[model samples]
Target: MYSPNFYSFVDRAKSDENGFIEFHNAYVSSKMTNSDLYFVLNRYGLDEEQKDFHIKISPSKTIQPKDKQVGELLEQRLSFEKNIPKAITLNDNIKPNIKVNAIEYIPQEYNHNSFNSPSEHHLIESITLQAHYVLKDSHKKNIQGDEQSLLKESIQRHKHKTKWGYIVFDRDEDIEQTLKQLNKTQPLIYSKRFKELENIKGEIVNIPFKEEWENKQIRFFAYLWRANRDVGWNYEYTIEKLRMELNHLTESAYAIFAKEFIRIPQLREEYQKTIKQISNEILAIVDEEKDKSKKFELAKQYSKEAYLLRNQVLNDIRDKSSEFARALAKSEKPILPSFESLIARKMQQNNFMGKFENLSLEQKTKVYRDIIDSSKNTRKSVNNKMIYYKVFGRTFAIATIAYVSYDIYYSDDRLKTAREHTNIIGFGLLGSSVGMAMAVDTCDINPICYAGFALLGSLVGSSVGNLINNATDTILKKYGYE
Candidate 1:
């Protein structure tokens, strides 16, 4: 129901300067008047006090000569007047003083704010101007005997011209009509206007009148007006077209985000449920296994399944996280860096050994430290090997103790004191310890470290026995007690 600044054509007036008469309204005169004496009036006299002027000029009372005698006399007089054409001057400087009698005409009641109301009826005002002139020839004579010159006699003349009209209505109605008309006339106006706006890059020029509007509607009214003034009414239609296009684009973006971006949370929930189910199944398998070695194998299988599932989830999140972030970025929210790049930078820090060109030196250092800390609690090869050896040694000790106890309790005394018995007991304990130590040190000095430690205890026992026998033989030989 809002209205824009309305414009209407008011009264137009003319003024004579030298011999020429100029017609113009008050607004045009104010803008164009410099050296010329211009009659000022509003094109739409909405601001002025409306007045009615009554000025009527009648034709001269002179009869044309029809007889030969009268025509011959008139020709002689016209010949004489033509010879002295410069002798008389026709002065058109007489300003027509128009006196508007307010009593004769009552002013119409006009509502300046009528467009603000919700009523459908609006007023239309119009004004018209007419001029009457008198022209004369110099060949006529009076009743007494005075010569009637063209400059002295008067005859009626009529010449008139009209200016373009103006129309005013509610801003919305005006815009609607303007759009409809422009569409009917030419559709390219919209595209042309948009193209022009696009061409205006860099710093924006502020339009003062547009800022005066309270809302977008009024602002659009001002915008349309300015555009109309600049590029003509042809471009006013572009505003509506542009607005429609903007709405469509916004809806499309929203639809895409709704269908794709909003599904991520649901997908993540489903994935979490799947992961939990897989983890439970794996734990069940580990729990059901009875054999120790088989239990270890089942745990390994669970670990592999868990790792694969986790990796799949991570990859899914990493890839879709970027797509979701992109969708959000394109929405009403502000722009930011991509999630994929952020994750990539995080992973690079963990796995990269060489210099990462993409990362800053400071970032690389921070990430490297973070990765080390995250993996700090993981077991090393030496710790794993030590654990394995301890468990294996305990099992072997139990077996050996059972065997030795049975032999000592049930076997004969001769068997119990046998050298093989002592060697077997000693070598078993020594060999188990050395074997465990060798397994722990197998990574130290390549092949020699592994071989040396693996045979150290067995070699020591054999060498000692040989030395003892050699000494005994040497002493026997020296005493000749072979």
Candidate 2:
């Protein structure tokens, strides 16, 4: 009832040595859940013929002229999306028999992100590493310094890819020609007359940027032509050269470029044709419909078809960042001078990343440091202002004692001299002790007990101090010396 589409590959060396090929990297379309699809494949995967449960291979490439090495191994991302026989058992570890098919052979080019999807950090790291290998020989020939100098120079050598998307090289016009050719080709595809569609076809389309050679043009739109893993554009030097420059321009041409510049646009044009054809069909149906009652139902059916078709197209186009663009987005210029003014030479060329993604490593560090410092200052200010329960209780006690002493002995005219001076000195001591003994380490005080004690102490101290003051005043007033 169900079949799966897989992105598959073969490693001949491992197969020959191990005597069995595995489909570990096999994945279905992004639409299907892996758990559901793989469970079915693991148990029920069968050959195209359905006689034996096996993978029927199509010959992707026979010989690589550039590599000058010929073998059974075809560098490819094979897609499996056909009927398969039901499983004999439900075991997950069951292996299917190998079935092979041969076709016109094509060469494989290396795509960096063709394998396990890597994070931005990992992607940059991989690009820098590969660049190092490319530049190693040149570096050795040019540099002959001390070990420390060599290490530091090596650090400079492996800088991140260029930030600017466009660079002006002596051969830029050559690339521009190719770019223009790529842009103009697609509109022509969509404008094909019926006679032209039957008579003429475009060349096999592949992303020129992902090729091992410098960017080149292709004629036909190759649907789902994913590059193999291993190589990137042999323009590491070009990227490195452009990166080290202080004045590389951000490209607006890529935006200005016409519809056929990328495969996504071509797919869009194809869908546009499908939409127009469906609309024309709906009109024809309207003309033929004699029964007026059936018109509404027919209109609803046509609208439903249009909605489904458009949504499916959008799903195919959505969130699919240009894998080719990612491959072309390599640049390595390490020296970041003043980030405040680095907006012209900014590292990120697109809006693909978060706020931090656009910023350089230097800018991020500076922003975070400022945040930490501000936080520290805020915390310190809060801690200083916070009056802990113990501190508040002690201060209140000191204030009450001072208040009582002033009201009684200090204010009394008939009070003995010793009592007056001693009470003044005691008040001073109590105030000093209150300031010194109170801890204000944080904005928070301890438990409810401390808070309760502080509140109760304030109330009781005020009452007792007032009572003492009243009694002392009465005694002083009744005395003859008062």
TM-score, candidate number 1: 0.19
Q: Which sections of candidate 2 miss by over 4 Å?
A: 1-210, 219-274, 277-296, 300-482
The lDDT values for all models are 0.33, 0.31
How does candidate 2 score on lDDT?
A: 0.31
TM-scores vs. true structure, each candidate: 0.19, 0.17
Question: Lowest-scoring 10 consecutive residues by lDDT in candidate 2?
Answer: 251-260
lDDT of 2 by residue, 1-482 (tens): 11234323221213436344443433324432322122123344332222112322221222233322321233443343553332233322332111111111122222212311222221111221111112233345655667456644333322211111112223334544443453464532232310111221112112223222223222221111111112112233333222222011111111111111232332333434444454566556744666544654454455445444444443343323232211111111122124332322232332324565566544543333232222112123323323342244334433444454455555545355334433333333333223222322321233233223333333444344445556666898899545
What range of 10 consecutive residues in model 1 has the weakest lDDT sum? Answer: 156-165
**How many pairs collide in each candidate, listed in order?**
9, 11
| RMSD value for candidate 2 | 32.5
Candidate 1, residues 1-482: lDDT per residue as tens digits? Answer: 00011122333444357434333222212222221111222322211111111011111112222322232212111111231222111212232122111111111221212211132112212111221222222223333344333222221110101011112223355655554564555542342322232222111122122222222232111121112321222122223222223212111112222223233343344344445555666666666777655665565455545555544543454344323332322242233334334335555746755445565544443443332222222225423443443344334333444555566667666442333345543443344235435554343323333334434544554355445556665887899965
